[model samples]
Target: MSATDEQNLIEVSGLVSHYGDRQVLNNISLDVRENEILVIMGASGSGKSTFLRHLLGLKAPSAGTVKLLGRDITTMTRRELFDLRKQIGVAFQGGALFSSLSLIENIELPLHEHTVLDKDTIQIMARMKLEMMNLLDHEHLMPSELSGGMLKRAGLARAVIMDPRLLFFDEPSSGLDPVTSAELDELIKQLRVALNMTIVIITHEMQSALNIADRVTVLHHGDQIFTGAVDELHASSDARILNMIHRRPSRHGVDSDYIDQLTR
Candidate 1:
């Protein structure tokens, strides 16, 4: 890839975070190239979600910086940050759709809230996004009416309703069966190609990571242990990376209790 190909759409430098005095992220740095699907993987409590909050500007990093499209979001004025957020979209874990609204309404909410478009126009755009996510027929369905996979697809539809340049997904396949999860993985890849979206995914699913990731960053103990292409991750000889890829047992044939406690 050329230098321009590596040009960053998102950059994090020396990131740090904490809950009270318990440090979570520590000196993290990473670059997300434009239009790339960069998967962030880690064991639970590795601070992946905390890092994501910083990237979304929902939580300020305790130290260091998070820059989006070359602007330091942590330091941006509220107006500037709001303007920047309009270009990005996030699909939080569990879909996070409005429980009271139908799929169409959920998707249209962003347009209604952020743009000056009339309801009819917003409805048309929302339908288009639903179609893109293979969810045209589910437009009128309420969140409670959809299956786990459908809920995820609906949330994805909502996230892309504005045709965002960058899309963030947290645990895209959580609480899903393998077959459905694999289908969702294929959909994610399709969306990226069709929309040319830069995707940042926070996931612990090794299969999902291997299937759709163009590049993967592995976090451990609040620090990055690996950041490279999927092939590099697979070929790496690093003990932590190897164990993660293979889902191997620890030295005692059992992961640490805290680590072993994570359900997914």
Candidate 2:
């Protein structure tokens, strides 16, 4: 292994996954470098979310190993995985905040559950993260009261409250105006530098990926079709990659045998 390989915070090797009879992921392998933003890009039903679940050890892979901070998450005991998760954070696509809790309560929930820190310390830490995400003034609002951008920021504030070594964000620009999406993209880059955390973002937005990705891995129908810098992606001649990047509809044919079986 090269010195660069030694610096990888998360390493996924030949990962495969399935939901019942349907295979969802092929042999997907990736390494997330320390302090870098790696975007996972794909259209809907392209296995991006399934791949992220494998990374988080949310679903056990059918084969292969996923290593986070040098520990194999696929094989870890529930207790072990829970302990290790303290060093990792995730911000879901829709913020996933509890509607019943205020923003500050939601943000500080992790500290309350995982740490023995005093209430004052937890509150202070939550506020620090909120301030970092430019959300300090809106800490008292409920999830339903906040705008999409503000909710994303609040989710992010919670994700980083633990000061994790690695962060996973799902669709950071999913449903927002162009200017708000651009602002969120900038916030992601800023968080990477400010927190010194390795980030893996799951997004289908080409503009957002290009805006913030240090490198990107593109998935197509469970296959890892491309993984490289944004410029390389743009310069590629592969029709599959180009079609995805250009928002062209896929013209793939269906399997005749599968159709016959379904109709029979």
Candidate 3:
């Protein structure tokens, strides 16, 4: 392996997955460098979520391998995988905070579950993360009491509360105004520098991708059509990439036969 490849924090090779007989991911491969923010972009039903699940070891691949933090997850035992997950963190799209829990409690969940730290220590750590996200005051509020942007920030605070080496974010910009989205983008960038983390963000938001990504990977109908620097993505001559970037509708819309089959 080359020096650069050896530096990869996450490496996926020939990844293939299926939902019963229907293939969802076709030979997808990519590498996420340590301390770099890699953005995975695709339209709905493009296997972006499936691919992310594979990275998290939530699903097994039909073929190929996934190596995370220098360990092959495909071969790891359940206990081994669980232990490995302690160094990783995920922020779901919906925030996924418990309705019954306050923001501080929600952020404290990971530290509580994973470590034997005392309550006071956990609270201090959670509050530190909350302060980092600019959510110190709202730590006492419930999930419903926060706005959409605040919810995203709270989710992010929880994700990084453990000071993980790897962090995953799903749709961080979804359901936010342009200014709020931009703020979240800046926060993501700052977190990478401050925490020295390798981040994988799954998003369809063009501006968010361009703003925070050190490298961008685009998926189309389960195939990885493009992966490169943001400028390379913009300067490419590929029609599909251009269409996606430009927000153009597909020339071939929904198939009549598929629609009929679904309806029937």
Candidate 4:
């Protein structure tokens, strides 16, 4: 990536989202550096997924700017938006592969939809990606035949098949065993190095975030509570940070005495 690209693959400022009168995200701003693994983390209702929707141009931000390669998407025309979004890839939380199609078919779906590549070349490219993810043999298998980890890998392979400069992952470790999750983390790091791709992951798995994030951004009540290196987060003295790291019960539902004892 060029120096300018390294500066900001994605930039969001004063971002907000609402469903009817219920505000989901509030005044959020963050930059995703090229080739950096940025982990966006928060509690269940902290707006992590909603923030991603804004970043991906799937939903309009209520009051903010979302820039891809420095072009604000909020005001962009449909053609411009489509052109800009072409440079990004998203791996959904559940893999979201077509249940009826084979793995290779699922991976090739994007290329077929977006590009003019010939059938033979697209097949070759799809196979290469499947092999890269160690799923070559399973390319003929349907989604129902794959394990949870394999399904995730297949989805990741499909995400990168288009060679997107920006990659988005939503809970890559959602339903896998610890060993499988760890292996997926290793694959993520490897892909980052190999493709020099900038990654933005939204997840609540502390271990996964700490293991792979170049930097971690924690959100609380729609505000950024912390942003720093993993080690800094581990060593920080901030109450919110400490509470999150140690899995402490929040005072939101607890009695005052319980909160006091917990804090003490």
lDDT for every model?
0.89, 0.92, 0.94, 0.90
Candidate 2 — which residues are off by over 4 angstroms? Answer: 1-5, 252-264
**Deviation (Å) of 194 in candidate 1:** 1.2
User: Model 2: which ten-residue window has the lowest total lDDT?
Assistant: 247-256
Better of 3 and 4 by lDDT: 3
**Candidate 1 lDDT tens digits, 56-84:** 99898789999887789999988999999
- Winning candidate number (TM-score): 3
Best by lDDT: 3
Please give the RMSD of candidate 1 to the true structure. Answer: 3.9
Q: Put down candidate 2 lDDT per residue, 1-264, tens digits, no spaces.
A: 568666999999999999998999999998998998999999999999999999999999999999998889988999999999999999998899999999999999999998999999999999998888888999998999999989998998899989999999999999989999998889889888888999999999999999999999999899999999989999999998898888887776457788899999
Instruction: Point out where model 3 deviates above 4 Å.
Output: 1-5, 254-264
Q: How close to the true structure is residue 144 of candidate 2, measured as C-alpha lDDT?
A: 97
Q: lDDT score of model 4?
A: 0.90
Better of 1 and 2 by lDDT: 2
Candidates in order, TM-scores: namely: 0.92, 0.92, 0.93, 0.92
Candidate 1 runs further than 4 Å off: 1-6, 252-264
Pick by lDDT: 2 or 4, better one:
2
* Distance from true location, Cα of 84 in model 2, Å: 0.9
